[model samples]
Target chain A: MKNLLTSFLLIFSLSITASAQQHDHEQHDGHQHSDHDGHDHIQEADPALKVPNAGGAHIDGDNHHQTDGHTHAGDHGAHHEPNACGIVTHHEFDPGALAFHHISDQNVYNVGPWKFPLPCILKTHGSKKIEFFSSGKFNADYHMTGTNAYNGYVLYEGIVRRVVGDFPDGLIDIGHNALGVEQEEVDGKARDVVYLCHNGNKLRCDNKSTLDGGLFGGGITSFTDFSITKNVLSMIFMVFLMSWLFLTIAKRYREREGKAPSGVQGLFEPIIVFIQDEVAKPFIGHKWEKFLPFLLTIFFFILGLNLFGQIPFLGGSNVTGSLSVTMVLAIIAFLVTNLNGNKHYWEHIFWMPGVPAWVKTILTPVEFLGVFIKPLTLMLRLFANITAGHMVMVIFVSLIFVFSKNGTSVLGGYGTSIASGLLTVFMMAIELLVAFIQAFVFTILTASYIGAAVEEHHHAEEHH
Target chain B: MGGSVAALGMGLAVIGAGIGIGMIGSRAMEAIARQPEAVGDIRANMILTAALIEGAALIAIVMAFLVA
Candidate 1:
């Protein structure tokens, strides 16, 4: 314990010293008005200039100028200044921006610097003007406005909206003031300007001009987006994986007849047997074969997807975290439970025998209500549990970014990261257990629902 | 303002659920202690009861989310 304590202390102080160096470097840049950030983008396009930031004329455009009062070119950063998604952002690792980007559905999948647009499919309500194209065509960040158009629809975040304004209404003083957007003179025309928040919400213009927020307006646009979002993609991937695994296992059973279980068969046999014996046999009874397939499929599917959610490399396309997915799963379970309800099951619910006539009146409505309640509860339980786990994990990881970010001291960032990292790991460890236990519980409960539906209570306290 | 009220509602739902599940567990243990032979059946019943309690609490939580 003493050695362990010393090592931890060593790690702690080392991080503090490292962050201190970063702090000094940041301070030097801050004094220079953070001109490096502006030039960094320019360097990407053209790196011929040795002194990338020396081009004083670069401030002419709407590149939300970061130039200082020290430079004669105009302190444009003062007027166009944004608070970086309503929070002071010191760097690109703004947790608020990163958090929502991870949470919400986007039309593009970004892995490091290489970004590829997911295919966006939208159809007109009645006109039937089907538009299918790569979401990258709007140039990733640019909104289809005025002269620029992408198949007559403007993409905002991921919502396809119709652009109707001809640039005049946005420029008018009445509309501009109403929406709290400020205007600037550009090319002999007054233009309303608002900066995009990290998650792509249009906020009042300031120097925090993120490219995500530029498109926010236009006309009578109606289109249904059937886009293949991240969760959908993850679900599709799971379906393919499960199908392949089961099919190969089915083939192996035929090839290795009467032999002891080995390889993939040995791997899955125990879980399959456990579900059949413990979960299916007792609750589902003699007809356990009917529901075993579904129970096994969902058990592995949910288990696989939950594990996928924990993987950082998957880009946070948490399939089960979304409520719609859980709702659909619950609905399927509900149908199977109710549709397969034996005659005796409905008899007990509708006109319960052994109960008094007056008691039946009160019990009947309650029993009826329970039919809907069971499925509703299943939906909520799965959705809430999975969503809560994800939110907790994200919040824990974001603590590192929040502390070390601009305005918040780097030492604080390092300190919080160490503390939060420990907590995050603890939560992650619990998540492993939760991932399995919840799946088991969900499966067992589903089995119980079917069991209750098919149960004949007449042989109570009697031998089999 | 709305968020805090929703949080309060969720807290109440959880507390009530905790009490209910505790009762279910305690009663189940009592039943098991008396009839150890039927432990499998008893365990299944306990889980089902606990799931029902959780289900009820989750309903309230969803309502609170909508309100907030």
Candidate 2:
């Protein structure tokens, strides 16, 4: 217990230092970008003055003072920067955006202050050739914003985005104050488009296409990313860890024969027995043995990923929290339940035996819809619970920055740190419980659905 | 404006779920008090029923997010 407490303190301290570094980098970057923008505005105004057009000179003078005041205000308090179009943008600490970003999968796995690059596999539209390269070539900074663009691709917030249109595309430094977001009409709907300023020209960047078909603010773009992202890496790691532990336990059981379980085997015996006795035997009935392996696989897999994500200062990869992952899990569960469904299940869904004709029509459609809705609910339940848990933890930590005013107030920072730390620890405890409950809930629900599909028609006859 | 409406929808959904889970918890407590030996079965059933109710509330919340 003493050792555990010391390690916990170590991780907490490391995370605090990492967050402080990121906050400082954001402020520093804003200052430099605004200064560069002011210089460019002055140069442009000088050219306008030389033209000797009174109206044009007056407009240019006003623009110059506006930018100067913006920069001056930025210097005294808030961090603000002028975009390429001379619009002053405020850079406040948004906890919501930060939490979302932290939970989203990325091409770079962050462990404390360090970011480890992953392999990038990208394919552009109308191109048969697939591009394979390490994300390290992009030279990503503290914020995961790459300083250099390679092969028309740039790392923005740890995700690889392709630059639109044609240009010289090897390794090129796009320079500071280049990235900006603008609202533009796409297909009659306003969308925030990301653009990069390179050599006095604005180049648009395309986000990776999503399967949601724009329902989630993502649509088909110039490229599709099939990268082994941070979430994928974490999933692979969890699979290997689980496999090793289970395999070891299996071997121990074989050697021990009839002897009582010991060591690691002792630890997992109760959980495995609980699922078998409580979940499988009661729900799956006579066919419990056939589906027990599948139930255990998903239960342990999800539980492992959940606990892995809770580890502070690690990559904290939100694998189970991701919609894509949960969707696939739900699909597999749906397939399993339907495939093993008996004749009674199909008859019950398509036509009720004793119901009136009109009632049967309504019942059939409702039952059919329920078949699909079951898995859909399973997918959303796990995804929402885990994602909300992660987001809450991040928001709790972000309270430190909010109270400290981004570290400008030393006393506030110190005082809020203690309170934020306590809140974070409390949230972590709740999240740990949620991890177990969600995994158990998912397994039991799947069992019940399977049970409904395979049950014999003897009960119906008895009712009649 | 749309965001605020979405938030309101989410809050309403939570309230419904809160009341549902509360009833389940209270009933489970009563059952446990009546029959201490069957506490395990009562607790498990309570969780399953509460999760089913939560599924409905979560669907509403997610719909509000997507629409708004």
Candidate 3:
């Protein structure tokens, strides 16, 4: 009866998400058509404003002219032309960009079409004072471009970016269609530079610096974001959920004592026992008990986050898929492995009793490199697998848009939706397997590395 | 142009990984058939080996992305 109830609940939730996704697509289609109509209306109204091709230089020149005209016309008549600058032109649907955006971390928790704002904590480069406010202060539109700038910061695509030049304090109406992107050369490399238009002036915007150090085209900028973003919120929620669940199961175990596990305990026992028996005991030998807790924690933590990310329309928080998260996990594993390394392990890496001095010279450097490479591989493996899974799923869904030519063809949209839906379901199932496999692989590899570090030197005697 | 070349490199890396994993799977299957009782152990080892190969391919793919 309980199993039936659970299955029914799963089906009900799945249906809800499916319908919500359909509605979202319809709304998006409407938005695209409306924007196209607005663009047509603007072009028809003023023939002089129409350019044969809206290139970068042409747009800039036109924008400057419009801003000069706005100043001469005064503030009252400025409301007559909302998109006077005409920056927000119709762009083709880019699946790659969309996939990246979906997987990337954001300051807002997006559920369906509704965006819930999170608190924003930011610090400027030279300022000692940290600014605190809700992201809702930006009054972000459907496209996540803020209509108002609060304290010189504007929300662009659900992220808070600081205006480059000096601006007034407090809420200032920047109006819609203010944000624009252009390619600019920085350090001999061309990169996208975001600019904001407000009050007849265009201002550059700065993105927060990333620790990747330009490897991913991210480096130092004007401000640093210390906000509790969507990924951070998801992690906090998962931590609480896992704690409550384990506490209840632990309490059950204490009460039942030697009796067979039931309910949630039964569901978890096999998985925990599998890790203990198959992973820990086999890899770590008799000292497995000492490392069982660490192994179990990572296994369950990663597994939980992986499955949590798979839930449709639940913000799709790609926690484990993020490089930063996996890097930290790998760092922890590296620290634990090396810290617990006995004299024998160090000797094997640095000297090697059985090998000759010439071989040692070559092997020593390679062995040293291997130590870092192990953890690096662990980080990359988890990040790549999860990210690729999420990207593929996004692209599969994007196929509907691709075939329909951005909602221009109803027949194509309906035809592709069925195929795309099936593909998404197939991918989801594979991703589910990948979630478990990846978590297990991470744990087992860590255990094996630990096992090698702590293994006894009985084999040395035989070699000697 | 760089993107297309990077994609070609990524495909080459996948080819190498695919071959490596396929060999591991076939060998593991043969071993499991001969010694049915050790299927569990063989499967675990197979997956571990496949993951290591996948790690190499992942590095190549990431390098490709960086190049692009």
Candidate 4:
């Protein structure tokens, strides 16, 4: 009954984590940016740079000076500066130049407001007609109309700009500027200007620049993305998977009592018993009882996280992929391993069984280094492996559409696309297996380390 | 690049450890299958041997990153 209750709670907890409502694949795919309601395109406002192509309404001319329609020898002989998007042209002597306009003369091509969702646009004149550009989501295609020239992204509705002057009238302004759009001139070449945009909304230049902010305050905090719904579900799914096996075994235990184990018990009992006998017994030795719970918790928790890494949406987030989170877990292992270490362990590390005093001093530092290095390696191992796996899967999946640039090449595109999908699925399946292996590895290692510290030196003497 | 290289080494390290561990498991299972009455003794020895192997594998896993 106790085991059954634990299994039930595990399933319930995982269900809460794996709840379909939370996995919102749309949000995970970065489609949330398409839902943006604000007008943030600064390039759409500039009339001179964003002239509709004479050939076709759909064909957008490149905004740079190299384009056919717009020509500028040096400064275009005007004090008017262009927006970052090259959509709006702001003049210095013109009315509202100081009031409605927010362009700064310094760093003439640089756009400010550094963040999005807030209605603001900052622009400045630059040496290059195309001042700032990046393939990130916030920046639009400066070369194509309703499409990204660089990334070939179709400009969805949410990416539309807010115009100030009437179309085909006086000066036209793009991008939402509640405080009136601002700008500045940059000293560097066209591409030299640092482009800013939100990771989620590439069209909105809202990412914190070097002048803005950092991704996280510290390494430890970076792992909290796991608290998201997708991660929770993946972890819970793994726990459910393991719990089912546990329950199957427990039922057999009840039925067979002292008789030979059958079915699920045969598969699982050995592993559980193995951990107890090999890892716990030798490490904790006489004092194993006190630390078993934590060891078990770490084992299960890591196993769940590793399993979570195999799930599609959750794996992409890189929860266990972050070095910080892994570091903390490794630190926990380190603490538990050392705190439970007996006198024999410390003496062996700092002093020695039979080594000379001079040799002992040299060995002590190496031993101390091992303590720090052990946890560090643990963090690196988990983070690197899982993050790489996720990255490869994302790239493989993306290649399907990315390589299909030709509108007519249906056969090649379809074949490669299907192949990529199959490969992605295969990798995901492998990832699931890896998740368990990594968790077991971490748990077993922790046990062994603790066991090492607690093992009797007399045993080593006898062996030698 | 450094990060990518670190990850590659990590994957290799884990794969190596998994293979080594699998061998121990196979041998232990083989022993138990042959002598059914010695299951308990075999189980205990298997665990101890697995732990020793795990320690070595873990150390190698850590060494995999030293090149980085």
Q: Give a tens-digit lDDT track for model 3, residues A17-124.
A: 454456447545545545544555445645567556368888778768765654434322222223435444223467897898788888888897898989999998
Better of 3 and 4 by lDDT: 3
Q: Between candidates 2 and 3, which one is better according to DockQ?
A: 3
lDDT of 4 by residue, A129-227 (tens): 221222133342221112222211112121212122122321222232111123433222111111222221223222111210121211221011111
TM-score of 2: 0.88
Compose the digit string of candidate 2's lDDT tens values, residues A1-464.
98997677566745664566567666767667556655676677666655664587676787687677756755533354555654323446779878988888899987967989899999988889898988888888877878788889988778889999875767898755566666786765566677777776778889899875454568888899999999999999999999999999999999999999999999999999999998999888888999999999999999999999999879788999988899899999999999999999999999978889999989999999999999989999999999999999999888878887776666666667767777888899999999999999999999999988888879779988
lDDT of 3: 0.83
Candidate maximizing lDDT: 2
Q: Between prediction 2 and prediction 3, which has the larger TM-score?
A: 2
> Whole-model Cα lDDT per candidate?
0.64, 0.84, 0.83, 0.49
Docking class of 3: medium
Judge candidate 4 against the unseen true structure and give its global Cα lDDT, from 0 to 1.
Answer: 0.49
DockQ of each: 0.40, 0.67, 0.68, 0.10
User: What ranking emerges by TM-score with the best candidate at the front?
Assistant: 2, 3, 1, 4
Query: Chain A only: TM-score of every candidate?
Result: 0.67, 0.86, 0.83, 0.50
Which regions of candidate 3 deviate over 4 angstroms?
A1-90, A213-215
Ranking by DockQ: 3, 2, 1, 4
> Candidate 1 on A204-313: residue-level lDDT in tens?
32221112212112122345567776677778888898889888888999999998888888998988898888899988887789999999987898888887777754
Clashes of 2: 0
For model 4 chain A, give the 10-residue run with minimal summed lDDT: A99-108
- Once fitted onto the true fold, the runs of candidate 4 whose alpha carbons sit more than 4 angstroms away are A1-271, A282-286, A313-317, A406-408, B1-68
Model 3 reaches an interface RMSD of 1.5
